[model samples]
Target: MKHISIIVPEGQSNLGTVACIVGAYEIFTRANDYWKEKGKKQLLTVELAGVSKNTDFHEGLLTVKPHTHISAIGKTHLILIPSLAHDYQTAVEGNQLLLDWMVKQYKEGAEIASMCSGAFMLASAGLLDGKKCSTHWSAADTFRTLFPKVNLQPDKLITDEKGIYTNGGGYSFLNLVLYLVEKYYDRQTAIFCSKIFQIEIDRQSQSAFIIFTGQKQHGDEMVQQAQAYIESNLHEKISVEELSSRFAVGRRNFDRRFIKATGNTPVEYLQRVKMEAAKKAFETTRKTINEVMYEVGYSDVKAFREVFRKITGMSPLEYRGKYNKEAA
Candidate 1:
């Protein structure tokens, strides 16, 4: 059987730890069972290591140990470094024994995967040198400063090069597992897995991959003004003409600069901002999706639902239903 070992460090976030377990169950047991019967051997084994405090409640359900030696690391086809503490400075000075074990495993041909800040651990292992990797955008600066040898592609939800895969921040961990399913099984199988998990699979192009999550900051005065204008007037109708006049820039210059600054045009950026706000309202308040949509500048329920789904990969109703049910 192909053994996939998920290695979670101590002091991991509760959310991240739960996400790892969900990935294991969804990819290995629920999804791999079908693939195994079809002539493939796949198994998932979770191994935990570290001296930090065990803040992950879900880890109690798994048979994880305090230390994972080289012998235990042997025989796994894939090794996942789950998301770790947000302190990038501490990650730069991570555990040496774990780093050495990872090196040994990589040398023995184990595919390495990292979710979110887990890239910090992989980079510390020196395995990501000269290879394109990604992490949550908030950690992009810290990652770059700490691991200059690694070619960090900040925009990807996940980047798969050779046997190494790294994911961007948030729940893109789910997307990473889905990518693995497609690789091992087929596109149809991946689609089935997505449906089972209620995950929306948005097949992305290269340009689209570069477009989301890793946009460069625009320090231009006009661009910043435009952004401020949009945020201050999110509930109001924001027009390009208003933005151009507010920023004292021509319409053509404003359009080009807006895209250059935030990676999306003014309208797209405004809609994304609105959707983000609407998401927060739906989760934190009892307001309906339609009410939140209108509050965020969207007057049309159909268009509001479409935009939320397009950006977040989930409709406002779906997001609310998922999170609200859990919150309750």
Candidate 2:
């Protein structure tokens, strides 16, 4: 059996971490039982290893015990890093032992997978540098600020690169585990697990579920004004030149500052702002797709639909049908 270590971050606090650990362990071990039922050998041996024998979370509301300490672990086939709750940096910094252990394990030929915000730890270990990784869409701005080298794809539900894997936020880690099952076991086994766990398999994008909120954490006054303008004028065409002039800034400098502050160019930010407004219209109104399209400033049907899908991973009608309670 391949040894699998789920390294619970030492003393890191998070509700999702507990769920990710329990959910992942249950799914993988149940897969092993399925294999034995079919007269095959067990596939994996899972261990909840940590830096110490015991760790507490959430002001000691929950305590986790490691099957093996980081100091005791030799080599393993796979390691999973669980997500954090509120504080990302503190959790990443607190678990220095696991961070070092991850680097050593990968160098010792172990594959790694991080669920949601656990990408912080993996990135901290220097594994995600020059690699495409996914995290919770809500955490994208903070993640980008910390690890500019890692290609952060928050729209993706899962990403696998060079033996490292990442998944988008929340319980979607189930889908990532199912993907791993298909790769490590077989398609049939993966299908069985998906059916057993009720996780959607092969889901490549989280766009349909994303609520497009502009990244505004940076303290750039001019960019904030530009963003507010774009948001307030979602029904009108926003010209970058007009914004720059109104804000008393040059066009070239405006573009550079906007990109640096918001992590999006002027055009992309404007498009996202419009799309978010259009999304609200789709979710709350009885308007037709074209009617909503016109409300969001797109005169051409093709242009509106293309931009809608580019931002939302679905056509206007599809998004409306899926989310608009009245339509449903």
Candidate 3:
């Protein structure tokens, strides 16, 4: 049986912590039972491994007991990290031991999977360096600020590469778990579990659900002004040259500073600002696709659709249908 260690990192836990842990156990064990019922051997041995000997009582509430502490764990095939409560920085600091243990286990032939905010822990351990990762869209800015080396794909629902996996926000860890089920078990079992849980199978991107609130946390006054100008003039065709001249910064220097401060180039930032405006139009106004596109300063229909699809993973009408109740 393959060993799966569900990590219970020490912290004032999120409300979903227990549910995420138990839910994974339920799915994997049920999958094993299904395999045996189909006349095969049971496939997994699961355990909740804690960082310390103490039984954890998070938020002065739920009491979580561990099956074994990490020191006792000699071999584990997979390590599952559930979401930590509240602040990512604070939660990670308290779980330093767990992070070190995770890195060690990962080096010893274990694949690591972090659910939601738990990606912060894996990132803290340096396992996420130079790897693509997904996290809660709300925490994307903070995550980027903290771990700039790790490639943050905030628009994705899941990211799996080189044995490290991270998922987007909330209980969507179910989708990540289901994906792992397909890899370790089979597609048949994954589809069966999806049907049983009513999960949307193979959901790859979280972009449609993400509201593009522009990132301006970096301490660059000119870059901040540039961002503000882009947002303010979404209905106008704004150019990099215009922004650089207006801000009194050179073009090459402006591009470098803009990318460093905002993680997006001048043109990409403008496009995003326009797309965000278009999204708001679709979500609120009963405008036609072309009307919305025009409202966001796009004159060409093909250009508008292509950019919208690129940013949102859906076409204009499709986005409207998905999000706009009035459009429905």
Candidate 4:
């Protein structure tokens, strides 16, 4: 039987973390039951292993007790890290012992997987260096700044490389669990679990759910001004050349500074700002596709649709239909 240790990290006893831990336990246990019902041997031994015996959350409203301590676990085939609290720095600092155990487990040939912001823990433990990772879109900027060596793909729903795996923001971890089920068991079992859990399987991108509020916390006054200009003048055709001149910076220097400050080129930032506005308009107003397109300063329908689809993983009409209940 394959041994799976789900690390119940200290100082991360929030509701989401608990849900993921319990959810994973249920899924794997149920998968084993399904296997056994078919006259097959039990395939997995899933346990909650942690550095601490118990962790409390919400001022003692909730407490999680692990099945075993990390030190007691000898060798496991997989280690699962649940979503951590949003105070990522504190979460990482407080769980140093757990992180060290995870690193040691990985070194001993254990595959690791992190859910949502749990990627922060994996990255801090040096398990994700120079590897492709996916986290919540809201945490992308912080993750990029903290782990510049890791390739961050916020748009992706899940990432798998070598023996490490990561999945995007909240609830999307269900999809990753289903993916793992398929890998550890078989396609039929994965499909069965997906149906039982009511989780959509094979979801490949979180792009459609991401609200691209451009990264503006880089402390660059000029970049902040540029972002403000883009947001305030979404109806205008703003050019990077014009922005550079208006900001009294050379075009090349402007592009370089913009990328450094915002993790996006000047043009990319403008498009994201415009697209974000268009998304809001689609959600709240009964604007026609062309009306929204023209309002965002895109005169060409083809260009607008292509860019919208590329950034959002959905066509303009599809996005509107999905978000605007009246449109449906």
Winner by TM-score: 4
Question: Top model by lDDT, which number?
Answer: 4
CA-lDDT, candidates in order: 0.69, 0.88, 0.87, 0.91
- What is the C-alpha lDDT profile of model 4 across 1-328, one tens digit per residue? 8999988888844788988898899998888889898899998899999877788876788888999998888899999999988899999999998888888988989999999999999999888998999999999999989998898999999999999999999988889998999999999899999999999989999999998888877889998998898899999998999999999999999999999888889988888888988999999999899999999999999999988998899998999899999976
Q: How close is candidate 4 to the true structure, as a TM-score?
A: 0.96
Q: TM-score of model 1 relative to the true fold?
A: 0.58
Across 1-328, the per-residue lDDT of candidate 3 in tens digits comes to: 7999998778757667787888888888888878788898878888999976654555556777788988998889999999877677888889888888888888989999999888988998889999999998888888889999999999899999999999998879999999999988899999988998888899998887777777888899989988888887777877799999998889999999999898788888888889988999888989999888877888999999999999999998888888889886
Runs off by more than 4 Å, candidate 4: none
Poorest lDDT segment (10 consecutive residues) of candidate 4? 7-16
TM-score, one value per model? 0.58, 0.94, 0.95, 0.96
Looking at model 1, report the run of 10 residues with the lowest lDDT sum. 205-214
**Candidate 2 residues 187-296, lDDT tens each?**
99999999988888899998877777888888998899888888887788778898899999999999999988988899988888889888998888899888887887
Candidate 1 lDDT over residue span 37-118, tens digit each: 7676654444444443343344466434434444554566777777776765464464555667777878888898888788
Clashing pairs in 4: none
Q: Model 2 Cα displacement at 164 (Å)? A: 0.8
- The local lDDT score (0 to 100) that residue 109 gets in candidate 3 is 90
If both were scored by lDDT, which would come out higher, candidate 3 or candidate 4? 4
**CA-only RMSD, every prediction:** 7.1, 1.7, 1.6, 1.3
